[model samples]
Target: MKKENLRQTSEKVWGACALAVKAHALAKKGARLESHRDLWVYKNEIAREIGDWVKIVFKLADSMHKNFYENLTTREDVLKE
Candidate 1:
């Protein structure tokens, strides 16, 4: 994908991750969460509590966010899975 499109797509992924983290934190602590990293860090618990697929999706979203800035993800990498 083009860099501009990648950025836009990554932003949308980041937004979804932020919302997911917010809902997770609110459910667990009744407070707001700051980072998408939390989801990956707690993937085991998330998988056990939510589902394995949720954890995988969160990880993918985080990767997309990182890729936007680092420019390390290729279209083939995205399409691989």
Candidate 2:
């Protein structure tokens, strides 16, 4: 991918991950249930959301890394006139 495109993609991914984390934190803080079962359910929901976000982050990171390495090896091709 082009440098600008890559930059934009990474920025979006990072922003999404950051937002997910923020949401998880807010959910934890807002969990005011007194019952153990309710708390457990709330925690599970938050954890699942966080986990999905984490997966997205990891996948994006991996894609970025792979793209970087592949592009590096093909630098000469990119520079060809």
Candidate 3:
């Protein structure tokens, strides 16, 4: 049961991290939104992304194992940057 919960949590967090990256890309131009609609949408997406990230953090902390964070990123991925 513990293992299952950890797996689910890991997947959720990984998905949320992808979302954060998407939001970051969208925000690269700064928040100087031109139209009212544009600003509203941008704020909406940012809020949702932030909320999901916080939820994932708390969930991970709840049942996190000692080595749960170990080796999360691959050496090749890091080297690609």
Best by lDDT, which number? Answer: 1
Off by over 4 Å in 1: 1-4, 42-44, 74-81
How does each model score on TM-score? 0.65, 0.36, 0.30
Order of models, best TM-score first: 1, 2, 3
Model 1 weakest lDDT span, ten residues long = 35-44
Give a tens-digit lDDT track for model 2, residues 1-81.
Answer: 466455445445444544554556567675345443443345446557556655444445444444544533243322320
Report the number of the highest-TM-score candidate.
1
lDDT, candidate 3, 1-81, per-residue tens: 344454445445554544554456467745454443454355446557567654444333322322245535333332321
Model 1 over residues 8-66: C-alpha lDDT tens digits?
Answer: 57657766876876777678768655654565565556578878897778778778778
Clashing residue pairs found in predicted model 1: none
In model 3, how many backbone clashes occur? 0
Cα displacement (Å) at residue 32, model 2: 16
- 1 or 3: which has the higher TM-score? 1
